[model samples]
Target: MFQSTKQTAQTANLTAGGHALPADWLGRIVLIWSGYAVSMFAGNAASYAGIWYATETTGSPLSLALLYVLAFLPMGLLSPFGGVVADKLNRKVIIVVCDALMALTSLALAAWTFIAGPSFAAVALYCAAFGFVSGFRTPAYNATMPLLVPECHLVRINSMDTLLGSISMIAGPALGILLYTSFGLQYVLILGGFGAAAAGVTMLLAVIPRDHGAHEQAGAWASLKEGASTLASQRGLLVLTIGVSLGMLAYGPIDSLMPLMVYDHFGGDGFAASLVAAVMGAGLLVGSVILMAVNPRRKLARIIVVSAFVVGTGALIAGLIPKGGYWAFVVCIGVLAIACAWFNAPLMTLLQKNIPDEKLGRVMGLFTAMNGLAIPAGTALGGLIAEVTGTPLFFQIDGVFILLLAVSIAISKSVRKLDAASSDHPTVEQTL
Candidate 1:
């Protein structure tokens, strides 16, 4: 039987590490997440529109590849510093200011596109700028989670966050196309601006708790090294991070290659590609909902390993689909997306449970930076490979690489030991 909302809230308050939660903590989280979701939806819409613009304008694989590289590279470079700032500053202020900047950026892009007409340069510039700002926002926002929610509800809230992102993925492309075809790119950008503004305002209205202690005593370089040492001190976590980073290096290009796969391999149009993306989003939504309902608190590492195998299998199958098998490809995409959701939620829960609150921002920032670097490198490599062998063959290679990576992780004693202990009561060593 499921506990009622009131009972769940009361239990959460009672078990919150000897700290009593505010009476309306749940409500506050809901309000903040809701606003963030709106921002994500609009931002995604604008992003897709920009992607489509690039696709139609250049029709080159390298252009698509460069888009992701430009978007993520700055964030990758800046995230460590961003993490240090997150640990040392007011997180709420960071989020609000970043959101406001994003809103203004969007509005400015809209105006520029309206005047100069759409260009790849403009899209690239926007991607670069957005990525830069997100470097600061991502670590701060992620670190704030443990402060707001109790340990027991961490998985649920993380799942909910991913679920909301899935929803944005499902709708963003559709809305982007509609607005792009009907009004113009300017309108899409304008909508994104409004959504970002709304997020900032809602965050302003909500009350968020501060970090347990001040981190301003340490210098920036020292703080960064401390965060890095903290992560390295945990053998299992260090191994896990390295493994995931390698996997992402192989898997990251899939996002950039999807439209090309649909167009070049399946002879499909923009709408078909969007349909496939939407199906993938649905798969993510299903996975997140299941995780939210079940709230599994144990064997998180095992879950990630199994999910990786499923994802690899799905990708392999998708790559093997025959021409005129677009629906089959879509089905495979959905399956992999579900597996991805499962993989992500558990990984995040494990980190949140194991890392102390004070250092979480820096650690997450470092993690994000690694991923950010790996993704662009992968995308660039994948683009070069796709140009020679076609997208289908690239997908097969990616899948095989991931499968091997997963097998390696599964056999490793260190990673498997991650699931041996109860995460509810992490030891001092684990937190350090």
Candidate 2:
């Protein structure tokens, strides 16, 4: 089922490590996915455990915010350089090395926790280290997808990736609570270490295709500039990227403020907040399943545009909910989550389909960095706005901003042209 018979001649010519495509490529790709699945679960569990530990140890809101920022800041700062490396080096080697380093870091964190009893400083340090390695790992893994799977299957594969991620999100917290309550943070960290090691080993077992001469002559600065130029050269992609980043900015506050919204506005407690979160997660899972079943191959830009509109409307409605309308708010949150789930797969597929493989890493890296930076910035801004106008009012404003952004994207001729452009199947040498 993973195999695609519709590979164009141009796509079929793509090679892995100077060798022809192997018959067992599907099996190899599945192995890579399996490794990632293990890591995702472990990483999520470790994050939950660490956050709980922090809450118990310091019980400071500022400390929790700092911990969250530390997790994303390094990745935001380092992703561009990591992308340069992904384009220049063997991507498989990058993945393997980063995963191995993460494994070692997790092991070290476990040992430290066992001895030091889970201080705030140690957890913060561990978060920074994990984010640092992930900055490198993410781009390589994203760029490697097209090399392993046929172009026709990109949407399905991307959907599957999101599906697994959603599963990890839903289940990881449960595992973290169980492990933390029963065994402690040390065991959770140990599990994380093993997960990372498993991911590294799977990458080692897989055969990943790479362009041997792509960006080989360019220095890091030159390559970085090229990635930027490549992004700017395509007006549609540039607009799309900006729009997505803005969407993240609008939506990011919801994550930070959801519990508060429940408490302050809806007059609900922690259980209600947790229920809302669980329902939203289920919405994401449902969206992934639908996308996988549909395997949309056309009008991806339209899908994105519509999804943004749905999310904006959902948020606006959510903000308008009265104190007694907790169920209504929960339903809106689910709808928003479903729309948000639709965003990634189509967008990533568009990038993979259009961006030349040689330059995909740097472009993906920059994309990741922008997105990573946007959420925290949005959260900070949202907090300020919420403090002033209140949580519901802030959501109302965020929703309006996003709705306008969606309309602007829909009206843009450049973005509308992306559908036709993606169908052309340009060769890797083509820029933009």
Candidate 3:
């Protein structure tokens, strides 16, 4: 009985990290994820500063919109190559380089905020250049994460990432609001810049173990071709990326217009606008925690199908609700965040699992790229809808498009069969 009990106890101590995961791997995730969390917090705080600083001093709505649009333009254009770099180079080095670059950008923003003040054109130019630099890092990190954790527990680790990011999302905006209100946006901008630099310093200390199985034989162009070809082969991942892109297109407008939503509805104070955004971030935190608790053991394809449906349903419901003003709109968005979290967590897990490590970066790059693929279009759609209708209809129509995309994925048998075998087959996806 004593021996049997000992065996049971040992089994209980073992986590999913034991399978397809290295020994002492969880330690690495904690070490790396902690550094990443701080870095992201400072980075996002700087983002909030950029938006609020531009809006308060310059008061240009277009400048405000430029903040969102310009930030993403880099990712949209360069993400494919970023992924290729992730596969060819050491992922740890890539992450360090990316964080270092962000640190520099943050410092530049701080300088610009103080020295240049708020020039709409200057801020626009600043944002565009910053966006260009960020594109390479996004895919690099996504592909690198699985190197830190095991496969079977991808959901738990992803939920962990979301939880950390949620902390950043909630804190960054709130910090931006508080600093901007009390110390002024200039100080907030400067502080965020320093924080990003500090994060870079922290990231420099992290050591990611090497993957012996990683692809190293090919040159940059040849490696790029191989990664692209693999993604193209995965019909399921391709469909999934496209569906995710639709949801992202719908969601982008929400961030761009939230400040206006707060003013129209919440009382026109910067605090009120920031509070409205914070509620959604808080909901995301809650939702991520919940997902971590109850990871689905079913098919990857099915989880995605259900998640998309839920996202569409939430957007539809939020759109159907009557908007009384800012606070009311925020309340609706908060609920929407829950739905978004549920769908996003599982979809992320699916991508991390099916794609091989060698090509994971570029694949995740393409995956991440899909998030912004329709942004230019979403902006046009949102602007047109806002003019003709209102925010509510904008949400509803985008929700419908998201739902249709999900349905398209569900209907394709080939796409839905990604989990039929446990083989780590090379996969391929394309946007154009």
Candidate 4:
């Protein structure tokens, strides 16, 4: 389905609307990026606390799990329409509006936590509301990045964003844990409210380029229709998306099962339980930095395919090893970190390069939705698998599934030649 080398040569568009960054544009980018990093820390600070609140108050894993299910479910279910909205509206406007709504939800959740105990239903409602807004925001955020910075600096900017965000993910959970253990869950949630509100307000101040609703825009159904049409036509791009989606599905079992396995198979908890997540995130940041130097487009198939294989193998080995300790666990997780970093940036960049700017949100909406949908099902399936075959056996079985994806892609000509063909084969009107 992908364009051959000869065809891509005709389609390549090296010179789009903007040139490489000048000094002023670089400064503006830094200003916006820094704001986003700070807001992310605050907006997500209460995640661990929310879980702790549900567990401590109700003594129920189901109560805590409710928050997660609510978060992922709406994001996946509503994302297609959300993408349509993004394409139909100004992206900056959509982001600002969504951030504001999230802030309100955060604030309300904090208020409720302070006044009374966390009812499972109340927490689920808050999580779901935030998830809905976030689901909408992701495509807009992805679509906006290339506009905020120059094409030449796209990789650097994306790497920096992922790096900083990964750090925030680690710190936020730890902070929530500490806040809940010492002062209590209510205070931590209040802090989360403030963070979300601040993130929303600062977003209003940042001047982002407008690229949404540029065309008359398609209706909701038409938006998805357009997205599918685009992918259907681009052979390389379609295979790439499917490969990544499958990778996510297979990796989910490891992510869901590993912690449980560590706690039960080995005797690690509290700080140790948290460390597993932190280590993986830390590895992701490190891997992202490494890949910044090694562009995926240069060897797109090898990286995506091999990295996925590594994740699958590492997960199985980690689960199967009889007496491995913290060090082994950390190392195996680091392997996954490598795979994840290798996968993210280029996949989206490839889409951005191939798809028209007017349709980015719509296309990314499908992307966002697929990712959202995959996570919940993967997680649920992992839990179910563990129940049947046991966690250790499930990880090993899932590892085999991940391996199958790599095998599938390696044999497919479209994916194997994607990078080389995309760069050389199409004209892409590169000199626009």
What are the clashing pairs of model 2? none
Could you arrange the candidates by lDDT from highest to lowest?
1, 2, 4, 3
TM-score of model number 4: 0.87
> Candidate 1 on 1-432: residue-level lDDT in tens?
123444544555642323467778799998998898999899888888888888778877889999999888888888898999999999899999999998999899999999998778878887887788888888888888777778788888888877988999899988988898788888999988988998999899999887443846898899899999999988888777877877778777888888878887899887887888788789989999988988888788887888889888887888899889999899899989987888666777778778887888889889878887888888899899988888888899899988998999899898877878755444333333
lDDT of 1 at 25: 78
**Candidate of highest TM-score:** 1
Task: Give the Cα lDDT of each candidate.
Answer: 0.83, 0.79, 0.65, 0.68
- Clash tally for model 4: 24
Residue 307, model 4: Cα distance from true site in angstroms: 1.4
Report the lDDT of model 2 for residue 402: 86
TM-score (C-alpha, index-matched) for candidate 2: 0.87
C-alpha TM-scores of all predictions: 0.93, 0.87, 0.84, 0.87
TM value for model 1: 0.93
Per-residue lDDT of 174 in model 3:
83
